[model samples]
Target: MADRVGEQLGNYRLVRLLGQGGFAEVYLGEHIYLGTAAAIKVLYAKLASDDFEHFRKEARTIARLVHPHIVRVLDYGIEGTTPFLVVDYAPNGTLRTRHPKGVPVPLPTVVSYVTQIAEALQYAHDQKVIHRDVKPENVLFGRRNEVLLSDFGIALVAMTSNYRSTQGMQDMAGTIAYMAPEQIQAQAETASDQYSLAVVTYELLSGARPFQGAFTEVAVKHTLVPPPSLREKLPMISADVEAVEMKALAKDPKQRFVDVQTFAAALEEASRNASSRTTFLGDIPVSQEQGASFSPETIVLSQQEAQEVSPTALFTTPDVAQQPSTDELLADKPATAAMITPAFEQKEAVEAVEAVNTPVLKEKETTALTSQPPHKGISRRAVLVGLAGAAIVGVVGGGIALLTHPLGSQTAIQPGNVPPGTNGGTLYTFRGHSGWVWSVGWSPNGARIASGSGDATAQVWDATSGGHLIVYSGHSDSVYGVAWSPDRKRVASGGFDKTVQIWDATFGDHYYTYHGHSGWVWAVAWSPGGKHVASAGQDTTVQVWDSANGRHANTYRGHSGFVHAVAWSPDGKRIASASSDGTVQVWDAVTGVRLYTYEPYFTDIWSVAWSPDGKRIASASDDKTVQVWDALDGSHLYIYTGHTDFVYAVAWSPDGKYIASAGDDKTVQVWSAIDGTLVYTYRGHTAGVRSVGWAPDGKRITSGSWDETVQVWKME
Candidate 1:
């Protein structure tokens, strides 16, 4: 095999031998014309001569089993009596190489790989082909971490010639440890493949094989002994998952799972349930009492209320007769120890009270409220008098204010009182970036806005006052994306320096720099729980890393072109990445397994944002459109074609009713997220708008532009 390293077999030039077994040698081969790499498995000359028909049959069987999870047989031929089969090359090596000794892989990752392999086996079984040899060594990974089931050399085709007898008793096919009880009796079937897969799954979860010994001993155990419980080896393995594995490893073929898909689905469900129980819920510590009282039904109802009410309803003034006194409202809402302060400076306390009392609208109630003529009876002075009275009462009551104040009292500046910078509803224009402001994001509390710039810095500014608060100046190159951690104490920024930097939100102190990306980092998004940050880059990969210590967690590499933007689902379980490959892919954040790819656009997709509820994703592309689609299945829900040029940014409103997008059109357009109807357009920036973000209050949007300004405004 070593001497034939440079030998030419048909159109393939063998680079080196990848591996070798008793019957065949696997070589790394390159196509002479296309320079594409392939794994060429060549049968030993002696074996080829004795089983030429069987070797050809193996090739035909693999060629017919075409699926994404199954390795494709590209070409096959006999060269001087040595038959060879060419299959897709997997650069990442095999599952055995990735997990050599039973090292416990992450639960999500174990389930993901098992489900993929099972699906592939189900497809092969549907074609009446039983992979007689099913083990981790035969499961290969492509460069993008795509799982491919390879080595169909020992597969059995229904009604085909029996080759097991020709090999004789000396060379019983399949790895002894993974063989099913029936397979040991030379009665291999689809169920036999299921049993072998169960062994692989068990090994992946617990990092140990079910039964281990010498070849003869292991074979005897497979035929006569029941497999050990996975939980016994790894107590963390849930009982449900162990049952799934044990059921698939049933001694009798008929007692095993009817199909590989059923077993895979069961394992996946168990994994998800376990993950949900252990998922991080963020920095907000919940006491046992609070956690016990948390009702998912109440949360759902709140979300529904938010989604149904117009954004205006949030600010609608109650009838004077229905209005509760400020003292009564404050008395009903007791301040927690976290919210109470001993020394209350009136000026600072007023600001704190206003911040604390500001209502963060529910996700469902984000739509623009029905436009109604203002009440002509109540004078503006009377409204101001009411707010002033509330402020005085708040001071007397130690900084406790009514939570639901009229919209007039909430926003200091009214909608029609447009500020300078050529806009109708502009509240403030922040001018500090020396170059283009590439991205803008609002803190969870809507208190601060962060913007990344070509100036090689990210600046955090007060959202309402437009006052510069902190300047993060560490990146050596232009900063592209900025995100606020869910706790609002940390900020994450990605830049042209091929790095992601986490810094203190208030003091501008650098926390850590993540340098895992090989290409310029384009976007950074904090997970909803604030524990991890997902970053996209020109390297065609999306990486999730620990926000605390900058530890690289996982890398997702399915995109063929540069990944421009990444966003986390609200639940923090899934991530969505938009790429120059013209696709938006939603993947598991923990497992790095791709879930869905949305490719409605034919040109580059520049940005992606998940809906507040995580049900949909909105993508902005160079195709001059912003598209909203189902996040789980990639079904196109709506397309906003109002932009005339490349749309660079897309953001879903915190309330979930609207989407704001900006691009080369030099304008920021707000459209109904539900039906893609045009809500309003802000044409304030002189240069193209690069990024836009929704204020946490759900009342305003802030847009950063190449014009070197960040404009905060509201839709009237």
Candidate 2:
């Protein structure tokens, strides 16, 4: 294999053999003048087709995709009788390395890897590209734990192929360890890829293939035997997680995950019970790569890369040469930390020791360590050279660290700019709000939405197929909060007139009213379990109410000022509220006991909400900032300072990817809660936006403003 490579084939020259698999051999190659390294896979000579049809088939399948997870095909054509493919060569190697010594990985690690690969499969399956060979070796890792699915040489395109099946008819194609049972019998569907994924996950978690023995035995076992229960092998595994694994590993493809997306989501839900010990690995590194060729037809740099590349005389036009050639941009990737050592040699150690003895402080600390002061001990020139070399290494190493780094960058939004089309005029303004629309909420089914206005009316509308639903009339003064119950069977509305009203979710018929507050009612929330409800108001109190009966079970008061917002924790065990006195308070809803208060200087609090999982609370304030706090201890997590005016309302995305805030600046901003990175700003309202709410499906956001118009934004 090594001898055959490095030989010229077609218009390309293979540099060296990288790796050889069952059906093809990967070679490191460089496009003549592009100065970049690329991996080309040549089908084994005996297996190569006499005609070039398979190469075209694989290229066509790859050409239809532009996903971050799927490996990119730079170019493809026949080289003699051998069908070859050129794909991205991930520096970190395969998913197989994730289990060296054949040890089963940690459950969390297994979950993370499987989730990513499943997402890749889901993407390919959506494009009607069946990998046909889903195995550990095909999933490659890039600079930041980034996952790239490769080896599309045998990908089955759903194009005019008569071999494609609507129903199962057994077929054998993938590696036995990760192959679906149906595939062993030559019956495959998009579901076969999902089954193979489940087997990969099983290997990751248990460190052994489900059917392990001779190849023939494993093949037979897959057709007739059930996998040993994961819980039996790993007693520490949760029953929920084990059950999910069993479902994914079902012998019949139909019994397995319906698709990769469904499988990934199920894994997420099953693993939701994890605690602090569970390690969180975010997005695997994903990047767009071009072949060694630098021509326009072959390369496309991402937006960030476009900004970083500067011009040179050799490459005249910026639009043409601004992007670095593939090798230059990717050459910075470094080895994993697990593979590096910490100690330094004596000569290098001496230099660092000498630099510390200098003036001790430089205007720039980072750049100061590279030289010795006039008074320093030891050989001055030697010390300077060593430290300079060390500094160079440090800077280069840092860049590499960033390359393979797996954490996804958060969306960054400019302060007050409207998100694209949301800029100039109101898309559609509802005119019924006689007074300020204090809060707005979309129905669970998304067919309708309800708004609480100062006119003491809870107005409902058909979100789509636009029309008015009903005007729920009961409160006397300003209605403060309106929410659609989880089941969408009921709607809860609170008002300044000291009343909490329940209405029929669809018909808007007034059901029952509970009288509780002494002053203005500020907010109302239904518990996640849907059995009970909680209300907070100007009475400086929080009340727990019975949804079944129009009765207040408990009233808890602790805020020195009016309680503006109330939200039930995901577990239904606690409640969080923001008060006018610049403090966010957490309470035990059952015991009516205050848990903690998040006090940050002299900023008055405006609104507060718990994340879907209840791990954190996002509080908007008069301080012109939104502060994320730990729900348990009230410790500050992140302070979002993009709002130019007082922040009036804040809400968490259902998926928790972002936190949306509305403020007196007449702008609404969506921010990544994990890192306080702003995604987009919505600025069409002519007056202060009083409230913001995420739609149930999380595809859109609704904002109620003093401008008297309810604006709905589409989150892209």
Candidate 3:
């Protein structure tokens, strides 16, 4: 315990003293022969003589737990009755050092660190080992900032010895502020670790502990008083997330989650359910070219501003200075030309038309259209001619319609009135589904549309004609997701039935059914090579399987919440999954090793779509926005906020120019993928739009709605 720097403890050359705790002193050490660094914890000589056997037993137990998130123990022995343990050296530092008191850690960082701690604790719990002391000080970070739960199982050993030595007085093993009520009462259980973790989570998020006072007072409050609401300190903290923290701090262990993993999953789910507000972080550079940047501003439109047809309206035609020529009107169709001649023959109608042809259509035309003289005798032909001229003038000059149309009137095309090839209107509405249409996907060739419905069936139809082709109907519950293979020959559908069914896309014949998930199957994706299908669900796992025979190939179990959506990288090397756990994880498809995770400080991510080139990812979430981020490094590229409600689905255009999103806002918004500019808003759906997808050619987008219809519209 003397100055051990420049000295050797057994074979480890002690470099410098790291820190000292009550029972042990930690030092940075290096292996003499291997030249590898380690953290050496040396027991106090007096205490080691009395509790050497107990410390060795606990250290051996902790060393047996081999997990990525848990600190690995290397060597442990006694050097002349002075016990010492060697552990993996975390170069970055402990969580307490990185995020000190009164420092507000970013929400994403808090969630990520907490999740790693929870996973490590859960693994230890499964091995019948309790951490007994869970605090930020015991959580270390490695060179890559990877979280490592340290000093596992040692706290119980120290506290037990202290209790006996002090004759049942006060035990001072764990940090007072983070000790659970049960721990203070000397009856700590697995739930005690969960409670302590919650305290650390609260401190990280709000920059203050839930209860702060004298050591005795803090212990009393943990046993009796309820923690203060997190919102009082951090108003932006979502109510749901705060609730999770409070639940974990419950005095009665029975009221809390049954396991540490469950508690962590609840916190993750609460983060997604929390209301999110994002600020514009100025323009972000995407490409390497200088000045090639896209503004990350969230374009939030007021109710009135959103409803108004401004100059930047995505779907509205630009105002024209000249009227449509007679030849231009007649060139499209001969039948419309014949009707135009009769519609303009009457002199009164001709005069009315001439009035509309002026520089601007006068407000008097609106008054004339709404109020006709009751005594004036008018032929039906003249009335028809006047109406036709008004319609033609409205189409020819956009200003004429805005000026003449009544306020709050339905000027936009109605559902059934959608015209073919219309620039910004619904092209087709497939309406045979008996229940809510929850998801939709376009065929790889863009020739067919497959829709999953709450009626427990998936319907295939002609993409252009809206003709129902075939129905795949074996699921006993709602179908939530559907996908088409790259070759366009097979389709995969997942549902509340907890199964993923693969079928022949051409004939609707069942091919194979995957039955591994233990919860509702919420999403399915086909690999680029069309050989594998990935499905994820409420089971908190992503299952990759061979599409032909439904043989399970791999299972990715990183997410702690329901996995809502999954997508394969364009090259088929990686898979991306969005979860209710507020994370988007990308993993190696073949190895099943997680590659990267994107935590965007939002709650439940409902859908994730990889960009066409596989360089970026677009995610839709309950945060009422669609976010685009770099696929490799997880850097945020753009945030599109056109949707006014929770965004449920996001689809990147095949050509990589646009991103289409549908959500509870009853609208589907298309935005430029490069600049996050709102390109168009399709608002024909009368209910929340659940799913959206782009055509293979990127010319159109299709959406399924709770209104029980699938609507396909031109993107432009």
Candidate 4:
């Protein structure tokens, strides 16, 4: 490649070559007309014709996206088939250069940096562009260590058009260290960018990549092994920060952050209260001698080892090169360290002198703030107030019992009732059911409870009163899943009948039956708008159906094995389904076209659910854990643990504040969704607890177990 510096092209004058690589060369350039400095990247002339079209498409896509943390794309053109892109020239170098080597930064700084990058990536995702590559090398640092994401050269347009390539490798384009499992498996999409961002953030805070080795080793680790938790290395790191990082690295894209903004917000909050102090990542030990040995082979310090290097030439920068001021150079010296006591004693005397010279106010305006009364359902003595009501019910026909606990003071509570976090609750046994209860859910208003049992029956109950509502017995085989519509007006159930039964919420009257899947329908969910329903099954398919009628809207087929769970994004535009083949697929809810496939775990994916904002997805798996991914680029966010057995189900609260997971371990764990912190763990069932659900108000949670009883617990 030849340098184009000093050559005029499209009102810009190239100044000097910045870097060169096989595919492209970047140059420091200036706009002859605007007189502004810019960075211009031009494709290699040899491969111009073949990759030019793709380059132009990507440039156009980026030029339309405007974000403060992203490198601004100002212009693009082709000069005799040599395609080029003009982007902003950041004064600070890449983040890779600015980072302190062999040292982990404070948690707050890491969060601040990653948050800024995530915000920029979120902006690009909202514009339907995926920054295929996200690594420290591509991020630039600005004043006060502000971060900026650069180089969208491999970005893919996410529009619903025929603009994408059929080439398999293009789908896998990204830095290897940061690529999500889906991208490594050649199924990359917008969500892949999210996974990459999580990897970058993990490295940013921990000072080491989660998985790095030979190409095959790293790939296998990402697919089969669990990532070490951030808290495990930095014991002092806050629980919230750990949760956010873990959520971002979820193996299932649907289970991860839906977009960059939500992930960034969570990271920001976590960083503000962070307190980690570990010096090294993983199990590595940090010794005093570690900083002394800077080998030339391992470290990349360019100017130092060169024999011709000069000290005066090295200190050429005007701002930092000058001799330090007398105050700065002498402030922290040993001599000044002994003068601290005198200065401290003089401080109060100086303040007293100033106070004597200042005048006192003659008149003052005073106002007092009055304490407001406690909320309607909240007790004045309660330490925690829930967002809504808690009710319990016992059902006869379904062999179920609901227990209601009001959200108030514990002083008036029943003798047998236990306060939140106590192991003093009763273990009531329902002996009527002879088979497993495959699925169970609480109504939005927390008034009714529903269950689908392997006995081929779907039953409803009054949650607060502990009375049986009705049993809708029509499916020929075992009923597997049940869900209440968002409006609480209808109920939908799927079973081995290969059909979905929709019933009137108040009664057991069957209203509509949707017949489509070739195998057992394992799970179903209502869209946020309540206009459509999504179902997945052993048929390796996902079907969207009309909520008003039994009409099939679309059928999605991509999973290689049984499809176990399905969930709708909060916006109703996307749906995610997890399969036994160890992949989670994101699809267009209306068209059923597979948009992205996440292949992280080596075993089966058991459940999938979307956050309330529709920006993230969470998936539980046979791997005995849950992973959160970026919903936009399929990036891994974080991995969650605590279950000793395979995770069976996962659900997000209506506020997207909490996550509840139940598994074969016979326990249910509630986590802080914002940061993946374990808040409460309920262990009562003698057998496996297969399903869990939260009330609409997010105050309480319920679980169905194979021990033949449904246990309801209040979440404080």
Q: Write the per-residue lDDT of candidate 2 for residues 1-716, one digit (tens) a residue.
A: 44666576555678888876544578887777675777777754422342346547656768666677777777775656555667766788888866552466666677778777877878887877677677788888876768888765434321112221101111111266576555544445687778778878766766666554323234433543345555445555555565566556655454555567777776766676643335433332311111111122111222343223221101111243444443343244332211111111112222222222111122222112111111111221222211111111111100101111111221111244334435643345665665557789888788787898755688998776447778988886667798878898999999856789998987777888888766567789998878888888766788898898867788887876667788888899998887765677888879988888788936457788889887888888766788887887888778998876568899999999899998866788888989988888787676668898887788778899755568776654
Q: How many residue pairs clash in each candidate?
A: 5, 15, 2, 44
Off by over 4 Å in 1: 1-422
| Structural similarity to truth (TM-score) of each candidate | 0.43, 0.41, 0.43, 0.42
**Candidate 1 lDDT by residue in tens digits, 1-716:** 34579999989999998887534678999999999899888765434354657757766867888898988889887776666778888888889888766356777877789889988989988988777677888899977899989867434321222221211211232266687755544446788889989988877766667655323334544543335545445556565566567667765565556688887887787666666555422222212110111111111112233234321121122233343443443343433222222211111222221111112212211111101111111221122222211111111001112222332432232222112223788998998776668899999999999999866899999998999898889997778899999999999999877789989999999988999986678889888888998888867788988888988899999987668889888898988898877788888889999887888766678888889988888899866788888888989887888876568899888889999999865788888888987878898886668899988878989999866789999987
> lDDT of all the models against the reference?
0.67, 0.62, 0.68, 0.62
Error of 2 at 257 (Å): 82
Model 3, residue 305: what's the lDDT?
Answer: 32
**Model 3, 478-552: lDDT tens per residue?**
788999988999889998777899888888888878999876788998888989899998678999999889898
The candidate 3 region of ten consecutive residues with least summed lDDT is 391-400
The runs of at least 3 residues in candidate 3 whose Cα sits more than 4 Å from the true structure, single-residue gaps closed, are 1-424
Error of 3 at 634 (Å): 0.6
- On residues 1-716, what C-alpha lDDT tens digit does candidate 4 reach at each position? 57677897677899999876323578888999779998887754322355656656766777877778878889887788666778888778887777643445666667678778878877877777667678777888655556788776424321211221111111121245576655444345666777777777777666666654322234433542335555555566555666566556654455456566677776776555443423323323332111211111111111222223221111111222233443443344342212223332222122211111112111110000000111122121111111000111111111111122333322231111112354333223333243456788888788888888755788888776547777888887667899999898999999877789999888888997888876568898888778888888866788888889978888888876668899887778888889877789998887778898899976678889888787788999856688888898788888888676568889898888888888765678888887788887787765567788887777767787655567667654
lDDT of 2 at 287: 19
